[model samples]
Each structure stands twice: as structure tokens, then as C-alpha cells.
Target chain A: MTLKKKQLIECQSLWKIFGQKAKTAMQAVKERNLTKEQVHNEFDCIVGVQNATFSVDEGEIFCIMGLSGSGKSTLIRHINRLIEPTSGEIFIDGENINNLNQTELREIRSSKIGMVFQNMALLPHKNVRENVAFALELRGIDKKSRDKVANETLETVELSGWGDRYPDELSGGMQQRVGLARAIAANPQILLMDEPFSALDPLIRRQLQDQFIELSQIMHKTTIFITHDLDEAIRIGQRIAIMKDGMLVQIGEPEDIVTDPVDDYVAKFVSGISNLHLVTAGKIMQSIAEYEASAGPVKEESLLKAKLDDDLDCLIDLSIKTDEPILIESESKIVGIVSKKTLLAGIQGHWNT
Target chain B: MADEVKFSILDPFSAIDIGIADWADGIKEWATNNREAIQPVKNYLNDVIIWMNDVLQALPPLITIACIAIISLQFAGKKVTGIVVICLVAIGFLDPRAWDLTMTTLSIVVTSVLISAIIGLPLGILAGKSDRFEQLIRPILDTMQTIPAFVYLVPVVMLVGIGNVSGVLVTIVFALPPLVRLTSLGIRQVNPSIVEAAKAFGASPSQILCKVELPLSAPSIMAGLNQTIMLALSMVVIASMIAVKGLGNEVLRAMGRLDAGKAIVGGAGIVLLAIVLDRITESFGLSKREKGVRHWWESGPIGLFYNQYKKLN
Candidate 1:
């Protein structure tokens, strides 16, 4: 799905080192290959982001996951230019955002992009409707029109009657929905959500995540979502990028990251997540020729069939229905086979053919 | 012999004098020479004080008391309204002269608070927005707050001479600092995330100040105004030394004649006025949610008439 759409946002070699000597530290990082700690010790600078590069296609939800201080939040702020990059280039819809003047940058922020914060930073003084209509008010839209749009957006978030209530009067989950409504009310093409659901209880978090996923699908907003939870990333992300100490360790599909992590850091994060739904048959299946050579030729009529993209749980169900190994097909041709042993191994985090 | 007996190797450093007193004298001369340039300001202040005093004195005491009761009922509820009404009646009964004197005092307090707000709010906002401006004003505010009112009173008398205008000027100098400091503090204390959200939504600096920061920090600003009003009341009494007339002058005259009964009456009147003003201004700081939700026409004297109209219809 991502292959066909145009790239809506792109970051190239982004670096953000926080300190007075950031320029010197950036120079040292470039010329002498200084590490994060080395730069801090030598130049009194903390590397906020280092050499980060990625792009989000239109209507894609790209999740950047990491522990705290891993620069995921810092990285997301660059998209809206809330925190200017120490050294790098950012392009939004093929325009170099760094080159925009203050007015032009604000124009894009108000009209082209919207952000949802983790803290649900709704203005406490304004009622929910006014808070949701804030961006429109900033654009000098009349109160009558902005309020109407705000009410409609409130309905979208299932907060129809909550327009008159102050933010402090709402529950954590409802406040977050208000935050989400505030962002989408502006109807910006791009959405930058920084841990929007991270502050809620487990039940509310899951509920909001589900609602957000549904909303994203309907809205078709190109999103850059930041989270520390790998489960959330696997649940919502079309592609996940794992960050560590201001660097992107690996970026790939959820299944790829789960089945084949680039390094131990990513492997550690993936270990905690269940692979039942993330691991696909194509990742664990053996070639049909190799499978036939090992055993005898497989009978097509007796075999249970599964798509190549089918997850481990589906393949397991197919294997249970029939005593034969599951046939993995791409289009009409059988590309691979997933037997019970391979399915069990796949669940155990093994991808041996 | 005393000089020879000095065992110290060094003498006190007295090679030159900085002549701060001389510079002050020069400034005094400049001020005296420029009094004509400042006559219009003094005249304007005198006219405003006289006009406000006339307006307050012209209203019947019962009408004034009723207005206060209605205002207190609207903002502070029934208990405060009762206390305020009782206090006003007590002052009037204690001394019939207290009523007219209280009006004079109220006029000065109101005018001073208004002028302080006008000067302090913008300066405070400027300090809030820029660290350099805050730094520049911090020492000035500290001097205004910490320096004795008596110290500045001399220059004030020299410049504006002795009258209600100088009294108002001195009261402003004394009352202005807290409002400025509290306003700056309030702006600084606003949640940073809220500010960031405003920025993210592409709010201009001025828009952010007006739409978000100002509204959120209103409670603190009101607190500042309360402080300013209280300070202005206290300073207006001290300003009586400069021949400023009012309830303060009554107290001063009683002290000179050693008339203890008269002093008690004047002191009681000032205290009553202070309590009433404090309660009224302090109520302004309470958030609307805490004050309970009510439409504008549903409280005060307006509410009384509205209910009557509703019943009639």
C-alpha cells in the first residue's frame, strides 16, 4: 500500500545536539566520528538526534518507538519545526521546510500539519469547543464558523456533548479524545502524534488506540506516531522504526522487525512482543521444492492453503484443520510450505527453513 | 601625635567622592525648573480626584451601600455581602463625618489602583516575554518595593508639591511593584506545554499572549491588583503627611490635637473601607468555575430585577 503513494515527509541526515556548543559537537561527530557519550564529555553537548533519516508515504502511519531519552519525541518535533534541527534537511510534500520564513513556516503549521501531544495540553481556560477551534481562531476564522467546525469535529471523536466542558472537568481518556479532536479539527493533511495514548490507563489506552486507528483510516492522514511501547507500534504502525540513544537502529515492517531484528537492541524490544500475529507464513515457510525434496511430493487436494501474508495463528489454524502442511501461495502459484514444526519454531522466534 | 600613634600601614581610601547627593540636588533643580512642564499632569490628576470625589459624595449613602451589597452578593455570596453592609453602616453611625471622609479616601484609592494597573500590566507582560527586559526591571521593581515610601516622598513633594495629586503619585510608586511582579510571575508560571501547543497551532506571539497566556494568568493578575489596591490604601494614609486631604487627614489632625476619640473614629473608618475593598477585589481572583456558573443577569441587582420581571411576565 505504501509503495504506490508519493512521499509526503522526508528527513535527511537530521542531527540535533543540545548545548551551546552544538555546532562544535556536530562538527566533531561528522569529522571525528565522536559517539554520543564522547560528544557529551568533550563538548558538553547531549545528542538529541543523530544522523536520522526516514520518510513517510501519503496516508501511512509510521511509528517511531523507543525508550525515554531515545530522541523519538525530539525526532517528531522536527517535522513541525518546533525544534529546529542542528544540522539536516527536511522536506514536506517536496518542499524544503527549513528554508521557509517564519510566516511561511507558520502557514504550513496552521494549514498543513497538526499535532496531538501526550499530555493532552488543551488550554484549560477555554472550553472543549474553543480549544478544538483554537487553530481556526489563530487563522482569524470567525467564531460562528469555527464553533460549527469544532462541534462537528467533536462528534467525530465521540465527544458530541462535551463541547462546553473545561478540559480539567474531563477524564483522562476524554481529554485525550479532545486533544485528538483539536488536532484533526484543523484538518491538516499531516498528523504528528507524540504518545497521544501513553498517559491513559491500560483499558483507556487500548480504547483510544483503537479509536485513533479507526480515525486515521477514515481520515487518510499521513502520520508520524511516536511511542515507547512495541505492542502499540505493532498494532498501529504500517512500518516501525526502533530508536536508541538518538539513532535509528532499524526501520522495517512490523513483521520484519519481529522476525529479523537488525541488532540486539531491537531483538530485546521484539522479544517481549508476541509474534502470533506479527510473524507471517512467508517469513517462516520453506521453498516448495525444498519441502518436496525433504518429504515426498505434496498432494494439492489434501493440503490446507494459506496466503503468503497470513500470520502464524492463521497458518496454525490451517495446519490444525488438516494433517497436511499448509501451502503458502502468492497469487495462484505455491511459493512455500509451512509445516507444524516450522510453525512451532516460528512462534518460538526461529525462522529456520 | 594621634596620627603618629596610628599603627596601620594604609589610610582609608578617600581620594574622591562620587557626589551622589550633588547629582540628586541637580535632579531636584531640574525638576523644580520643569514644574511648568508638569503642571498639566498635576492639574489633570487634581481634576480627576476632585471629579471622582464629587461623584462619590453626590450619591446618597444608602444608594452607595446598596450598590456595594449587590456587587458583594454577585461575586462573593450572601455572607460577605452582609459583613460589608454592616461595616459601612457602623462607620456611618460611629461618625457622621466619616461618610464624606470615606468617599474622599475611596476616590484616591480607586484612581491610584487604576493608574497602577495601566502602567504595571504592559511592563509586566514585557518582562514576561523577554529575559533581558525582566532582568532590567527586576532591580527597579525591587527598589520600588523595598525602599521606604518616605525616601521617595521627598522628591515627589519637590516635583508635584503637596496635594492629592502628589499623594496619588506616591501611592502609585508604592503600589505598582506587586502588580508588575505578580503579572510577570503569572505569565512565567503558565504551563509550558500549553504554550508549545499554542505555538504548534501557529499562534503568533501577540495572539498567544492575548488568547492563552493572558486568560490563564488572569487569576494571578487579579491577585496582583488586590495587592496593589491594599498597598495604595496604606500609602494614601502616609501620603496625608504631604497635606493630601481625606480620611487620612482626619487621622493626622486628630493625632496633632491628641483627640483620641476622633482618631479612633477615623481609624475605624479606614479599616472598614479596607476590608470592604479587599473582599471585593479578592473575589475577582476566583475562577468562574469555583464561583459557580451563573449568567451575568442572574446575579447582583440586575438579577433581582430580572426575577421580578420574570414573575410579572
Candidate 2:
């Protein structure tokens, strides 16, 4: 998507170091990016996040994908001041949050930003209703009203009637749903989820992801999602950013990133994604009547389409004569056609040419 | 017939008396030799002795009932129970003469318990946080716990000489082991995952202690406190010997004159106090079972605790 909406949250040149001399070394940081070894040596610091800059527009599902220690969680945490950026400016809705006082920061935490952690991190001692209303309570909502909203939030997450149950009573997926409801119950402007579904089973993870997709459409809350799963970033994120070490290597729409990766790290991630069943007909369909005809008749739609598993041998279908424009049929008639050369080139991203 | 004339007379001294003197002499000799190695234990004993003497000399009678009742309500929450009320009322009935003496005895107990908590809590923290501290304290705690209540007095007498101070000292010495050790054990037993979670939540050290550590480990600490108080109570007669006033002296006096009724009533009263206090302490221990100190959703979550939660709501 284009940058059509107003930006809600932005980070510029963020840095974090973990030692007594962090202040001194941070003073010496001149360039935009610092090497891990240099950071470690200068201050005996563990560089948690480095020079990270990104702006999440209102209502956008922005994802930061990285492996463990890629600093994605730390970077996201900077938004809420959960882990204060060592030396950077985080602006929420055009206001620089670096100087927000304790009370102001707490207000922001309760009313503006909500988060979901990897372990679900639900207060185990409380039941679903209590947990759902927990942050709301922190913000000072009355019991009757908070309970009403908590129940509604629970219903939104498809967890209605489960509110009376405690965290221990729910399964991993259910607990995460509770976490989701908790985050959204306060009706915050932005939601930050750091691998919230990482602990659930695969089936449950997919289910929750789908729910998020539905909810994001209806809820329309700006969300920053963090995950290591590339496909997840593709399926759920409108725009996905890939990170390695502590730097953003690439960021783009899911298909654009998958079909045309920025570098080897992203390419490696793209190649392993097998959920090709989700690719639309519009993405792969082509016109095949442009080339020379062969002996046998092949459908235009068939010639234009090739599965990810299909090789060049698939062009040997009798529907088309040798050396003719490749063709394939759809419901009733021949559709667009293409030659093997053109098809291969398109798969190789020659469409731009 | 001439030799039998003297033998027929009753022997003046009993064999049991001879054995008691030998045991006392042996302990004194051993204590002198091992005094240096046992300096910490000795210091602890001295502190207990001094504090107990002060309390035994100062505490009043009616206040003892109030202490028991207050503690009982907090602990068991069964305020208005007949037995508890009866126990409270009985203190008032202890013939007007017994009133001041009862409180004198009580003042020593309550104060020593307060001191025990102050001292034992830190020691328990040390023991809980460090394996080496625990190892170092194990034998000493074991000795304190295992030694008879009466035995504490002998050591108290040796160190501070006979008086209320020595009596109170012996009570504290015998009672503190449980509280210190259990507090350590309970804190150590709290779930590490929860502690880590609290840290991730931006909880400061003080907040973690007040919110997570103490609330979670309350049961064990209360258990320790309860044990300590009961042990302090047991030291009464032994304490009375050191001039600490209380029912112990009444029992001892009655015994001297073979006054069976006074002895029975005094002993029964002490037993009643023990039951009342023990129930109250166990009630306080129930705090551990209270919902996780986190907010509940209904009345604007009870925030991290009762106070902040109230403010938030």
C-alpha cells in the first residue's frame, strides 16, 4: 500500500546498549548503523537494537520478521517505552515520546498502546473476565462498565462465556486469544504483538492468524506484529519488513517481497514458502495467442498457467502444436496464451521488462 | 541391729538430683570451650535475652487478649466465633490478681515475636537468597529447634544470669528458627517464571518484594512466626525461673505449695492462648492463597495491589 494514511507511530535512529559506559559510547555513535563487534567493544554493551527507523501509518498491519535476537521485539518494545531506546526518538502521533514523564507514560501505556507477549503473559491468577479487564482496570474503569467492555472484547475474540475461567483453565491458543482481547479491550490506538502466537500449536496459530485478519478489518486498529515466520508475515501483514542482526534489510507488500526478494536472507526465506494455493488467478494468468501456433490445440488458460511445482515438461501437453504460442482453457473458451520462453521469464520476474 | 539402725532411715538426696547436676556441669564446661565457635548463636541468644527481659518487665495483662483477638481476626477471619470470644473473656476472669501478671507475660511474648520477625525476616532473606547462608544457618537453626524449651533457659542463665531478661531471651532463642528458615524456604519456592514476568513488566526491586515476593511467600513466613510465638509461650515456666512474670510463675508457685487448682487453671490458660494465637497466625497465612496480586477485571482491576488498585479503580 502507498503511504496514504497519516503516520501514527514513528521511530528514528534507535539504539540500546547494556553497560555502565553505555552513555559514553552512545555519545560516540555518529553513523546510522553500528557493527555488533564495535558496539560490544566500545562500551562492553550488548547492542539490543540499533539505528532502527520506521513509521507505521494509521490502520496498517506492519510486520517485523526476524529470527531470535534479531532485535525485532526490542525495537517494537521501544514504542511503548517498555524498553527505552538507548538513544533515539519515538514519536506517537507526531509527539516525541522520549520525554514523557512517568504519569504520562503510564497513561500512554494504558490508554494508547496495548501489547501481547510471546507467552500470552496473562496474569495467571485471574480469570478471563478479570484478565480481559486488567489493563482497563489499571486505567481506572469502573467495575460494571469494565466488565461490560471485557465481555464484549471476549466475544470479539470468540471467547464469550470463557471470562469466568482462569488462565490455567485455557489452552495455549485460548490464552493468546485472551491476550488479544486484553490488548484490544481498552480500545487503544495502537496494538503491539510480539510473537503472541509463537507458543501455540501450528493449527491454533493459523486459526488465530485468520481471526486477526478478520478482526483487523473490523477493528481497524493500527497494529505492529512481530514474527520469525515469513509466511505469517506474508499472509497477515499488509507490508512486511525483514530484519537480520539489528537492521531492516527489506520491507514491502507480501507478494512483492516473496516474488522479488531484496537479498539472499530474504530470498532464502521466500524459497521455503509452499503455501502457493493462496496465489490468485489474476497473479498467474496470462495471454498466450501472441506466439506462433503448433500442431495440436492447447487451451490458452493452460498455456498461461503453471504451478510452482510444474517444470518446462508441462509445455508438452497435446493441446498445443510444437513451436506454437502456449495456450490454456478455462471454464468455456481459450484464455490468454504465452510461450515457454515468456512464461519462464515471467516466473523469473521478466514482467518488468 | 546396730548397722541397720542408720540404714533404716530415709536417704536425703535422690539419684535423679545427682544426674541433673552432672548434666548441668557437663554443658557448662562444653559451652566455655566452644564459645568462640558458637559466637553467632551466642550473640543471637544475647539479643533475645535482652529483649525478652525488657518485655517481660513491661507488658500488661488485658493487652494480651487484644493482641490475640486482633491477630485472630486477621488470621482466621472467623471473628465473632464463640470460642475466640470466650478465650478473650477468660483473660478478664483470671482473678483480678492474675490480670497484671498475665499482661506482663504477654508483653514479653508480643515484643519478642516482633523482634523475632524483624531479625528472622532478614536472616530468612539471606538464607533464601544464598545457598551458602542457608548451609551456614542450617545447623544453628536445627539446634535451636531441636533443643528443649527448658534447655534454652540454662544457656540464658549462663550468659545473662537469672532475671526477666534471661527468661525472654530464652524464649526468643528457642522460637526464631522456624520463622527464619521457613521464610527463606517459602521465598525460594516461589515460581521463578513469575518473578521473571514481573521483571519484564518493569517492576522495580521494591515493587517485586512488596508485590510478588512477600505475597507469594507469606504462608511460610506466617508459619515460621506461628512456630516462634508458640515456642515463646512454652518458655513461660522456664522464663518464670528467670523472674519473667506470667502464668508460668503462678503454676510454679502453686506447685511449690502443691496448689493443684491454681496450676491447672494457669496451665489451661496458657494452652488456650496458644490455640488462639496459632489459629490467628494460620489465618494470616491464608493470604498466600488470595488471588494473584494482579488486578481483577470487575471493579477496575484491583491493580498490582490493594492500594494502587484502589487508586486506579
Candidate 3:
């Protein structure tokens, strides 16, 4: 969440079209009075992704949230060239990726980026291990080595010993966990998930979001997670980019986005959503000593409970070693204590800008 | 006290006529026409024919049927039992001379089917790839199929004369439509998503067809092949009147002499052949699903082949 802009994968003025004559029509726009919409109408090309741009930093869960056909999918696809950009550039680790050949692009895809499609797109034919091994297999890794890595990756997603099961055999959440394993197994520097949990039940989705957040915590893969639900974006994303009709309407941390939306589209999304889901380690995270902790250390206020998914009640009367230690009170006793500097430093990157 | 009407392929509609009266004129005209179309028809009836005379003549009735039995054993296994038994019984009851004529009819039908399949599959793929070609060929297949089975013989008899070659040729014309229609339909019905999946996996167009489209549509294509084989069988009897030997000739010869016993035996021979042909082609479709061979290219025999290919490459 504290990853910097230099670590960001950035998109600049991206446009994508769904038609054969896209290039020629875009050219016509360049030469004459034809506007983008005019050219689109004349040529029967849809401007699915239009002049969109955003940045997602390393370790930040950047979510692109929008309704179906709002170009959120098209824009996310631009990151990995599943759908190519009609115009503009995408830069990952300061390298522009639009001009790569098929081989070069596939290499980039195998190493630099991974994707979990909305449908999970688990090769219907392969069992869990094989699906997880797909990107590695594409990279020409031999079966034994890829299988070993796949098992380890499945463990990381809490799906150990499920390596032999088929995607259809697993529950939707488990299948998604397998899908997430497949994406993360390659250890791609950037992970792209297109509404991966949309197909799961609400209870399962919340569990998955928590699981994904915990997994990302350790792996630190720069994740671009797409979803339509504002609550999902606010809960899981460190920073969220709300998209509408092929444009990025706002890009900010979840709390900032909820409180100060840039447009009516984002405003409408934020209004009905529960603000509770937006509370994360980065928000509602106080400098432990700054709050009144006279009763003792109230470990419930600590970011570890929020970050690690450990029970808040487990931290009762828990002690911590810190310079300039301050007490945190739950009810009548000290639960935990930590240095104010350490608490605040975890939240440093966002407050300045 | 007889009803007289204008000469036509249609029926005379006499009060004495039954449902089969509709089929009567076409056969009568066909017989009259077959005698006139080729001078050799009369000669072949009384003398030896080359492919028919040599191939069917060299094999005794027992040996000829034993070959069909062996083929059924290899391809269809247990299902061949009833067919083999029925064939043996039918051959036992048939007048001995008619067996050679029936084998000739069987030979032509099998040969024409092979030719139709070879031609139809490629043309189907062509139609699948291009809508323009499909639109152009659609009506031709329609006309080729819809023109009555007996009516086609009149024209083919004119072109090549009433002989064994023309008989087989006419069978091809009648039976080919189903092959062409089914192949194109199967290929066209291949899943779009699967096609995209193959392309995304870097499969070339030919690879897509060989691996994805063709295997998935095998059932449909097999159905077409089955129907074509049936169509060829149906045409054999009509074709037999014109010096095409086999069961059709036996049936016609029996009808000429008014022998119901000979007619039933020949008809039974045709039925046995039809069952044998149907089972084999149906097995060809069933073979894919027989031993859990969905996506066969992934593993099993195909995977072994791929491994060998990789080594060679």
C-alpha cells in the first residue's frame, strides 16, 4: 500500500477499438473534422476503451470498478494486451510494452504480468496443478519443476493438497483460489484479476477478499483487481480507479475516494456502499500511542489485527516492545502497545500527497 | 375392364392399385428406358461383365460374405454377430447365381461412398471458411439431394449408358448431398470460444481444424456419413435394372420371372448390407466417445504422437 509512483505500472492515454478498420478510422480522425465519436459511428467501431490512463504501484491493490460494458474490462485488458490498445502506451517498470511482438509480448506476459479472467478461464481440461502451472508451462519450464512451484503456490492460497482436483470439481471460491494461484504462481511482477470473485457468493466473496489481501501482503505482487462492486474495491484495494464508459473518473485510496469522489458516477457508487469496508490498516489506523490508552494497550486498535486477519480479541492484554511505548485500552486493561513513530510510518506515503 | 392413362412416372390411379401403385410407373419406365439406353444391358444380362463378372465371379457366395464378416469383426466386434448371422441366413436362402450380382451392387455402393466422403469433407471445410462458397453450393446440394432417386438414373444413363460404372456414378450423385451438407454444418457448429481459445494458444488455422473443430464435430460428420451410406444403398436397387449387378439385379430378375422367394432373398441381402454399413460408420463416431477420449490430443495416443513429433523436431 505504501509503494511509490516509481514502482507503478502506468497507462497513458490508452484507446482501444473493437473493429477491423480501427487504424484507418483513427487515422481519419487525425486528418480532418471527424471526432473520435464521429469516426466510431461512421466506421462501426466501438470505443470500448477511450483515452484512459492510471498508475498502480508495486504492492498496491489497484481496483478498476465499474458496471458491465463500462470499459473497465477493456481497459484492464490493455495492461496485458489481451486486447491491444488502438493508441497510447502502457509502461511497467519504466518499460513501454505496446510495441512488443508476439514472442516478446508472451515473454512479458509469462514473467511480468499474470491475469485471472472473470470466468476464471481455468483450462477446463486441466486439474488444479496444471492450471496453476499454465504460465510456467508457457515459459517452457519442465513439468517436475512447475509442479513443485504450483504446489507451493497453492499452499500460499490456502489450497494445499488440492493440486489434483479439476476446476469444475472445486467450489466457485476454491476454483477462484486456484485461479489466483495460477496468476500468482508465475510470480509475475504485476497481477491482473478481472472480477475474479464476481461469480462467487457474497459470504464467499468477503472470505476471498480477505484471503487475497493476506496473500498479496506476503507476495507483494502489484495487483490490478477489477470489480463492479464499490465495497469490494474499497475493502480490497489500497487505491481504486473507478471507470465509466472507458474513462478513469477518479484514482485514490479507498477512504479518500469514498469521501471525495471526482464525479457523479463515483459519487453514486460511494453513496450506497458501507463505509465500514473502507477501513483498512491504512485508514482508521491511528498512531497507537496518540489515542487515549489509559486503561492499557487496546490491541484492537492495532493494524496487525486488520492486516493479518487475526482476531482482534486475541490481542487483549498483548504487549509490544517499542521506543516511547504508549498504552492502548480495550475496556479496563492494557492489551498492546507500540511506538507512535512506527504506527505512523506504516501510513506515511499517502498523507503527504 | 382395364384402366388406361397417359404414360408418366406418376401413377395411373386405377381402383385396383394400392399404395405401391405410385412406385409402379417409375419402375416400369425405368425398365423400358434401361433396355433402350445401353445396348450392352441386354448383352450383360446374358453374358459376363468385367468388374462384376470377374470380381463377383471369382468369389463364391460363401467367400464373398466371409469377407464382409471379417470386416465387421475387425471394426464393430460384438455388434457384428446379428449382422453376420443375418447375412449368412439370407445368402443361404438366395438363389446361388444372384449372389454374384448382389456382390457387384455391394461393391459399387461401398466405392461410391468412399469417393463421396473424400470429396465432401474438403468441400465442407471450404464452405465453413467462406460464407460466399456456402451460399453458392447450398442450392446445388439441395437440388442434387431432392431430385428423385430414380429420376437421376435417367440422366446418368444418358451420359454414361446403363452399365456398372454408371450405376455406381448415379449412386454417388444421389448420396453425396448429405456428406456435403453435414460436413459444412459440423464445421460451422464448432464452438467460437474454443476456436478463440485455440488461436490464443497459438494454434494455426489448420491446427485449429485438425485438433479442435474436426474432433468435436465427428459425431455430426459421422451422422452425415451414415445417411449417405443409407442413400447409396437405396439407390442400388434402382441402379441394378441397368446391368448393375448385385442384390438389385437379383430383385429385378426375380420380379421378371415372378418369383417372390428370390425377390425376398435379394431384398434380405440388401438389408444385411445396410445394417453392416450403418454399424461400421456409427462405430466410427462412437469410437471417439468409446473409451473416455474427450480432447484426445491432450494425452493418450495423440500425446504419444506429439512426444514423438517433438523429438523429431
Whose TM-score is greatest here?
1
Estimate how well candidate 1 is docked, as a DockQ score: 0.80
Better of 1 and 3 by lDDT: 1
Which model, 1 or 2, shows the larger DockQ? 1
lDDT of each: 0.91, 0.73, 0.71
Give the lowest summed-lDDT range of ten residues in model 2 chain B. B295-304
DockQ of each: 0.80, 0.09, 0.11
True contacts kept of each: 0.77, 0.02, 0.00
lDDT of 2 at B288: 26
| Deviation from truth (RMSD, Å), model 1 | 2.7
Two-chain complex of model 2, DockQ on C-alpha atoms against the true structure: 0.09
Could you give the candidate ranking by DockQ, starting with the highest? 1, 3, 2
Candidate 1 residue lDDT tens string, B256-294:
999999888888889899999899888888877777663
Q: What ranking emerges by TM-score with the best candidate at the front?
A: 1, 3, 2
Q: Which window of 10 residues has the lowest lDDT sum in candidate 2 chain A?
A: A275-284
- Calculate the i-RMS of every candidate, to one decimal place: 0.6, 4.1, 4.3
TM-score of 1: 0.94
Docking class of 2: incorrect
Local error of candidate 2 at A213, Å?
1.9
Q: Which regions of candidate 3 are displaced past 4 Å?
A: A1-10, A19-45, A55-61, A79-84, A90-115, A120-191, A203-223, A277-353, B1-107, B148-169, B238-244, B252-261, B283-313
Which portions of model 1 miss their true places by more than 4 Å? A1-3, A292-301, B1-19, B294-313
lDDT of 2 by residue, A1-353 (tens): 85478999998978877678877667766543457788787668787776788888999999999999998988887888877777889999998888988767777777888788888767655578977887766656799999999999999999999988878878989999998898888899898989888888899999999999999999888999999988788788989989888788888878767767889988888877742433322344454433334434554432334343343345434224555554444564555455556555544544431
- Taking all chains together, the TM-score of candidate 3 against the true structure is 0.65
